[model samples]
Each structure stands twice: as C-alpha cells, then as structure tokens.
Target: MNLSLFDQFMSPTMMGIPLILLAMSIPLLLFPTPTNRWLNNRLTTLQTWFLSVFTKQLMLPLNIKGHKWALSLASLMVFLITMNLLGLLPYTFTPTTQLSMNLGLAVPFWLATVLIGLRNQPTAALGHLLPEGTPTLLIPILIIIETISLFIRPLALGVRLTANLTAGHLLIQLISTAVFVLLPLMPVTAIFTAMVLFLLTLLEIAVAMIQAYVFILLLSLYLQENT
Candidate 1:
C-alpha cells in the first residue's frame, strides 16, 4: 500500500480537500486555555511560569523599542514548539516540515524587520551593504555578497526548519521499518534496534524544541539589528 518513505511528508487529502488546515489547528487545541481569575490553578500557574521564563530570556537583550515585539515573538515561539513536539507523535502531521509553510511564516516577519530598519534607520541599513574601509577592488564583490546574504535570510529560516524536521521524521521512519522487519527473524537485534529507536526519539524531541528556539532566536537577532 505504501509507495515511498517520503510519502509520509505528503499532505493528507480526502475527497480532493487537503487537511493541512485541520492539521495546523490540532496543536492549538492542545494548548491549555487560561481563565480570568485572581487565583490560578496548578496547570495555569505552570504554563504562566514557563512562558514568563521563556519570554524574559528571549527579550533580555533587546532594547525598549524591541520590547514591543515581546508578545508576538512569544506567541510565535509557543506555536512553533507545539507544532514540532506534536509532530513527533505517531500519526500527526508537522506543518513546519513543509518548506512552503515555513517560508510563508519566515518571509513576512523577516521583511517586516527589514522594513522597520529601513523606516527607522535607513542610513544604517544601507550602510551595512558597504563597509567603512573597503578596498576599491573589493567594493563591488562585497556589495554583491552582502546583498545576497540579506536576501538569503528568509530562505535560510525556512530551509533550516524544514530540513531538520524532515530528516528527523525520515530517520525515525527508517529505523521503525527496520525494527518491524527484523523482529520475527532476529529478536535480539530487533530489541537493540528498538532501544536505539527509543533514544533517537528522545533526541528528536530535544531537536524539535531546539530548532524552534533557534528559529525564533535568529528572528530576534535579525530584529535586533533593525530595532
């Protein structure tokens, strides 16, 4: 019934309707909803604590102007981490694994940062393209290189998230298939393989969290230069 291992990454469809929206919505539901009360319960307390810590650490380096982005950046971080960790579950889709989706998320925010820099400090932004003490021979080359790197930021963000998630999913699938095939003929080997798979799964979970952190951290860094 299966065609290729990569098929796991394909968007699921039924009756010609893609379920990507449905998939993307699932993680939102998993998040705990807060209540308006003076005294919060344990779960809400824990969630609040975690978010406070994360946001504080994330925004510590930014200035007052950049502090305006705290809420947006925090929400983005939560959404990304949830999507990633949820995708690691069996039979769940990873929206972040799609390069199109990742790019959609990347480009707008990145462009916004650039536009902010252009609006607030155009001279500094343009100045970044040319160094103060550049040789005549290398000016053209340096400008071209800087231009290319500036344009590459969004592409890099999208590709980094996609490749990391895709690779982890593929590896887990491959090892799982190998374990299933070997179980009957080689029980000992299969058991060892399963142990390895267990460890890898743990590693993948960390990677899921780390990639989300790194993605937003890079965005914050970009925002830093502009703000």
Candidate 2:
C-alpha cells in the first residue's frame, strides 16, 4: 500500500544524516586544529588522546572549557535518538531507517576503532586477535572468528537500526490497513485496530530508545576493546 500524504514528505535518510553531520561538525568548529592544540595540552599519552578527542570545543562550563568533539557527538546522539523515538508517532518518519543513515552512523565508529587499535599497539593489536594459548592449527580458525566479530559490530549496528525502524513502521501500516479493510465487515474490528495502533505507537517509542541504547552500547564496547 502507498504511504499517506504526510509520510510521502518524509525521506528516511535525510533527517538522520544532517544530525550525524551536525554531531561531527561540533568537534571541528571548536578545535580548528585539534592535533596541535591537543598535543600541547598534556604530558601523558592517554591524556593527549583524550584531549585530541575533545579538540572540537562546543561548550564552556564555568571555569571548564568544553570541546567541540564531545559536544557534537553528544548532541547528535541525543538528537538522532530523540528523532528515532519521535518517528514512532503515528505518521512521523524516522530517518535512521534508511541504509545511508545507518552507514553514516556506523562507518565512522568502525574506522575510529580500527585506527585507535592500530595506533595504540601496532602489530600487537593484530596479533591480539589470536588466542595466546591456542594450538597453531587453531590460531587461524580463532583469528577468522575474531575478524568476523570485529567487522560484524558495524554491520550489526546498521542492520539492527534499519531493520527495527523499518519493521516497526511497516507493521503499523499493515495493521492499520487490515483495520481499514475489516471495518466494513464489523465495527468491532475497527475499534480493535484503533487500540492496537495506539498500543503499537507506544511500543515504537520504547523500541526507539532500546535501539539507541543498543547502538551506544556497541560503540562503547568497541572503544573498550580497542583501549
């Protein structure tokens, strides 16, 4: 079935992308030259890294200076997550349901994880993927599994987001359609359809938050693994 007139106005990828870009831009705007300023600020390597991560300063809290990197990232996450949940409203479109949006969100995180891991430990990071005590024959198999898991993190992020949003929307549409068709047969079916739609709308709100949490959790785990 065709989407309603309002739904036709919404593009799945458009909303999420701008938010992603907005999030990325925060760091750049605050720290025009993050590498240099960040390096100058600290003696420890970890501190230097953290400084670099926060080069883009977006906020200044009392005496504390805020970095653009942290601000933008937080803003994007909040905005996108909020938007995602909002889309669960009867006819609102969630941009995150699109593949481009999902990829836009996932790719940078994946690349960042790879870069950090390689930078931190070089060959050791690569070698770490293999089990230390495994037999030589088993090393290859284990490495293969590890490699797959590493790659799957991003893949999972994209798929989980797109699938959940898309499926939820489609389900609502299908159920609404069934209700419309059945209404002619019996008035009671129409009421049931209305109730289900209302209930599902509420469920979508929960799903949006759940998916956002899952995305952030995965991102955190990736960072933890690299660190």
The TM-score obtained by model 2 is 0.67
Lowest summed lDDT across 10 adjacent residues in model 1 is found at 1-10
What are the lDDT figures for the candidates, one per model?
0.92, 0.65
lDDT of 1 at 205: 97
Query: What local lDDT score does residue 183 receive in model 1, on the 0 to 100 scale?
Result: 100
TM-score of each: 0.96, 0.67
Residue 208 CA displacement from its true place in model 2, Å: 0.7
Q: For model 1, how does the per-residue alpha-carbon lDDT over 15-83 read when each residue is reduced to its tens digit?
A: 999999998888778777887888888887887898899989988998888888889888888899999
Q: For every candidate structure, what is the RMSD over all alpha carbons to the true structure, in angstroms?
A: 1.4, 10.6
Error of 1 at 166 (Å): 0.4
lDDT of 2 by residue, 1-227 (tens): 36562362256346456444443333334433336443553334654464444332222221222122354455455555666865665545566777777888888977786787688766866876886789988887898999888777788889998888888887778788788988989889798888998899888888887787677656655655555
